[model samples]
Target chain A: MEKVVLGNHAVSYGVLVSRVQTISAYPITPQTLIVERLSEMVADGELDAIFTKVESEHSALASAIGSSSVGARAFTATSSQGLALMHEMIHWASGARLPIVLANVNRAMAPGWNIWTDQNDSLSCRDTGWMQIYCQNNQEVLDSIIMGYKVSEQVLLPTMVCLDAFVLSHTAENVDIPEVKLVDKYLPPYKLEIKMDIDDPHSFGALSSPENYMEFRYKMQEAMDKAEDIIIKEGKEFEKIFGRKYGMVEEYRTEGAEIILVATATIASTAKASIDSLRAKGINIGLLRLRVFRPFPVKDVVRVLLNKKKAIVIDRNISYGKSGIFFDEIKGAFYNIEGDKPKIFGYIAGLGGRDVTPEAISDMVDDAMRKDKPEKDIIWSGVKL
Target chain B: MIEILIHGRGGQGGVKASLSLASAAAKAGKHVQSFPEFGVERRGAPVKAFNRISDEPIVIRSKIYNPDHVVVLDPTLIQSINITEGLKKGGWIIINTDKNPGDFKEFCKNYKVATINAKEIALRNRLGSRAAPIVNTAILGAVIKVLKVSDKESLAIAIKEFVPVKREENVKAAYEAYDEVVFEGEV
Candidate 1:
């Protein structure tokens, strides 16, 4: 059934359909509704999951880790500062190789005490060894949770699904809820063969000496490498069952285009409007949305930009002294290439919840047209200085 | 696409107003998106919410700048806010006021002005207290009447589904506003 719901509620519905066994969260702005709905479902006897009302975001994730280690499909959610507080557990959850699913509402980290949507919060956890999927719409937010679990379980890695705070978390949109039977058929119950058992107590994640630690790290890296193909395989099977096609990246009118606009999250959705307008103005511009952020789609991204003349990469988050977070990643993907490559310009916009309207995007395209090469590594769009 | 901007104060269901309108539009077989300008919310502070409705899919996920219509749930908001910042000409400015629609024409010229005593209707239906009336659902009724975006049945269903309290009374209030919606003059 389809219903109009806030994007946060969409995440809750996704968890419900996934038949998650353990739910843990601490209330945070833009992320409260997600857990609130899940709590209601648990309390009202709808979803038979244990709702762990923890004291801190750290405890929230730690508790999820505990449940997942016991072979329960666990879930947790947080935003900005809450996610920051869980940084330690972030590494612990992945290093332990538990298939826990987390929904992160991407809010700008605060020194100014702001609570708005931005990508910096999740981007900061880039090397967490967790699979991350950034969604452009509420439907994607819901679908990614189910898909994230299916792939993560097979690869034995944690998955983090991200959506822009308020832009998605609070916005109301229509989302079709997939059938319970179909989700069940696609994702069966979690049964870990190696779990902490009460009858047979075995220590896990104990002191790792130099002799064994390297092998553990190598095995984790191997799993991440295997995850790339698993994501595509599950995505195709998802489309066959759910009738919605998803991939590492989605292309819009990019065939034979000279210029391509690379955007992520909801900003990519807004860029489509600007692409339509730019197309009308006779500009050969198209859009390429980077959907799966981790196990970062280097092969797909490099292939997409090979023939394009120039690429405009827009990021809503920045690395303090370096370029935009996504700009750095996309550029690094082409570092080893020797042949001609698209001169990718990085434009940082919409940080701290500033509106990146279609007109503002059009202005960026115009600015890109004027420059053969960007004067700087990073250009701030609509900033005072 | 038809974009509508809503003006109200925090704690007045301003955000829910936009949601219900989009819900009604979605019920009417149109694609819709609704979102509020996320702010440090406090009661009595000015708040804005937006909705985009279209027969085709709505792709642009950004703030609505040039809305085709405006819905004002509180007349007092006009004193502190520019209620028509980016509203288009020849569009409807639906206001919830007891005053005549002609009284707003000076400030709302070159547009179709509409007035509905949503506060009175809401109070009569006991939707909220006399001091602070729940006029969001009532104003949506007048909006649908002026914009022809949805019918009374769709508005009723949307209100019944969205409003957390006083569902029957809110539905009744919306139907009354749809029936008693006033127009200042011909556009």
Candidate 2:
């Protein structure tokens, strides 16, 4: 059914349709509405699940980890400070190879106490062995959560569905919620081959010697590598049922384009508008919306961007001494590519909920198109300094 | 595309009003998007919410700078906020004030101004407590009346969908404001 709902509520409905067995979450700004709606659903008997109200984010993910280890589909959500609190549990959940799905509303990290949108919260956890998928709108939030569960269960790796804090989380848009039977067919009951079983006792995350520890890390990497294909497969299956297709990366108007703008989350929507306006003026420009950040779609990124003359990456999070986190990733991805490649420009913008307007994006495009090579690797767009 | 900026206090349902307006536009077969500019969320803090209604899908997710219309849910907010900061030329400002349009002649110099005694309407309909009247729905009604984008019936359906309690009161308040809203030229 089509309903005008907030992006956070869409996450709740996604968890509902996925038939999550256990929900463990602590309230945080932006992300609070998601779990609040879930608790209401559980209390109203609309969703038959165990809603565990934990004291902190650490306990929240810990509870989800416990539930998933017991072979139940578990879900949780958190934002910037809350996610930072759950940092250790995040690695533990992934290291244990639990198929847990989490919705992280991306908020800016702060000493001055900001609760607005940024990518630092989720992107900072890149070293953790979890797959991350960013969403652009309310519909994508719902669809990606459903797909995150399917992909996570298949690959046995935790998944984080990230959306911009207020840009997507608090925004309301028309979303077509899938029927129960259809979603059931797409994401059936999760059955695990390895779980905490009383009948067959075995230690899951016991102490591993250095000789065996390397192999375990390798195996986790292997599973993350395997998730890319599973994510694509699940996305295709979801599209067949719901008529909305998703992928690790979405290429928009890239054909015969001279300049390409790379962005993720809600920023991609603004980039699309910039592309539309730029294209109208007879400029050869395109947009590459990076949906999935982990198990980074290296081959797809190379395939789409290898031929472009110039590419600019717009990142909402900074890596401090380094450039934007995504810009660093994209640059590192292209380092080993043989032959000529696009002159990649990295831009940092929209931090702490600063609006990345279409005009700013268009100016970035113009600057990128003019320069044959960037004087500096990273340019902080729209900042006064 | 028609962009609208709604100004209200934190607890006055500005965000809810924008959502209802977006929902009404969507129900009328137009694409719409609505979001609130969230700060340190607290009751009675100055808040702003935005809505975009268009025939085509809205691809720009930036904060509305040059809005085609502005809806002031609380008349007192006009004293503090530059409510007409980025209002487009020939745009309209629908305010929930008992004051006459001529009273805001300097403020309404660049835009069309419309007013409605929404607090009186909310009191008559008993939408909220007698001390704090819920004028969001009534202001929403004035917005629709000034813009003529969506009908009263469509907005009524949206109010029913969003307002959990006092649906009848909100719907009645909306229609009452729609009927009694005084435009600058009309007065």
Candidate 3:
């Protein structure tokens, strides 16, 4: 049925529809509502799942890993600091190839203890081998969760769908939640091809020597490589059942445009508006919204921007002393391509919970279009003393 | 396009005000985006939230710098914060205080100002004391009446969606504040 709901509640609903067997979490601002709703669902017997109220974010993920190891479809959630605390467990979850799904309400990490939305928290874990999908609105936040689970289970990799903390989390929007019957029809119960068997009593997380470690690592790479196809297949199946199909990347008005802008999260919504506004003004601008971050859709991005003369990337999170996080990834993808690479301009904006208005984005696009020389560098937008 | 910034304490429904404004605008078939900038890192701290409403979807993710309208839930916050910085020319200001618009104009110039005792109206409407500071529902009435952009049905749907259970009280508070808030005259 269709109802108006907040973004965080949509994630909780996604968990419910996905039939998650084990759930765990610790309360954090912006993200607290998600766990609260899940807890209420568990208590009211609406969602039949083993709910684990853990003490720390570490334990929340560790508990999920434990549950998944025993062959149960598990779920958990957290934000900036909570996600930071679960860093070690993230590696553990991914390395073990468990198809667990986590919803991270993106928030600014603090020395000042701010709880506003930003992307740095999740971007810091880019190398953790977890398939991450950043959402643009309430519907994407909900749909991505279900899709993340379906994709993760196929590849045996943990997945995280990132939503801007307060932007999507606390804000309410009209969302159409499919019936449980539809969800069930789309997502069958978790069936494992390989799992720890208590009766067989096999060793798990054993020490690896150099001779065998490479083979295991190669196998994990194979799983990640296989994820691309599985994600597309399941996304198609999802469309058939739920009437919504999401690709690793979505192009908005990029055809015949000279400039392309890439972004994730609610920022994509803003970019879309800017694109539409500029289009009406006779500006040749388009947008590419990245749905999947990990197993980064390198080829798709590279192919999409090949003919575009200029590409502007707005990064909400900074990677400390280095360039914008996604800029580096996108550039790396174009390094070996045989065509003229689009001149890439990176803007670091909206960090530490700063607002990103349409005017600001318009200015950024105009600046990128004005570049006299094509070079690789990053610029900070809306930065003040 | 109209940008609205709301200043209030964490418990005063400052966030609720922005969401309600967004709901009202969305119901008018306007593209709208609303978000709270304040973190619940501490209670009773001066908190702010924002709303952007236009006929088209918004793309700028920046916080509202100069708002077309500013709503202050508490009069005391005026001293604690600028409360007027970045206010657009001829912008509208809505202040919920016992002090009428004349007293508020002493601190505000270069714009249109509206003042009303929303807390008193809320209390009289049986919205209770806790929600007294959150005159957003009442303030929304004044905003819609002054802006003349939102349909009455849109305001009704917004109130219903935001204050569903206390429909009567919310509607009463809205009407009371709408009556008292002076757009170009004495309260």
Q: Per-candidate DockQ versus the true complex?
A: 0.79, 0.79, 0.34
True-vs-predicted CA distance for residue A22, candidate 2, Å: 0.5
Interface RMSD to the true structure, each candidate: 0.9, 0.9, 3.0
Q: Which stretches of candidate 2 lie over 4 Å from their true place?
A: B100-103, B184-187
Between candidates 1 and 3, the one scoring higher on DockQ is 1
The model with the greater TM-score, 1 or 2, is 1
Assess every candidate by TM-score: 0.98, 0.96, 0.86
True contacts kept of 3: 0.40
Error of 2 at A373 (Å): 0.3
lDDT tens digits, residues A1-385, model 3?
Answer: 6555778999999999999999997999879999999999999999999999999999999999999998899999999999999999999999999999999999999987778888889988988889889988788888888888888888889999999877789766556788888888878889876678877788889999998988977877888888888888888998898888788898999988888999888788878878989999999888998888888898789878997888899998888777888887888899888988788888988887777878888999888877864465679898986
Evaluate residue A175 in candidate 1 and report its C-alpha lDDT on the 0 to 100 scale.
88
Error of model 3, residue B102, in angstroms: 7.9
For model 1, the docking class works out as medium
Question: Global lDDT for candidate 1?
Answer: 0.91
| List of clashing residue pairs for candidate 2 | none
Docking category for candidate 3?
Answer: acceptable
Candidate number with the higher DockQ (2 or 3) = 2
Can you tell me which runs of candidate 3 are displaced by over 4 Å?
A1-4, A109-114, A197-201, A208-211, A320-322, A374-376, A382-385, B21-32, B40-46, B53-60, B75-92, B95-117, B129-134, B141-168, B175-187
lDDT for each residue of candidate 2 in A1-385, tens digit (9 for 90 to 100): 8889999999999999999999997999979999999999999999999999999999999999999998999999999999999999999999899999999999999776898999899988999999999999889999998999999998889999998988888889888888878999899898988889999888988889997999989999999889999888888988898899999999889888888899998999888988988999999988999999998989888887887888899999998888998888888889989966988999999999998999999988888877888888788899985
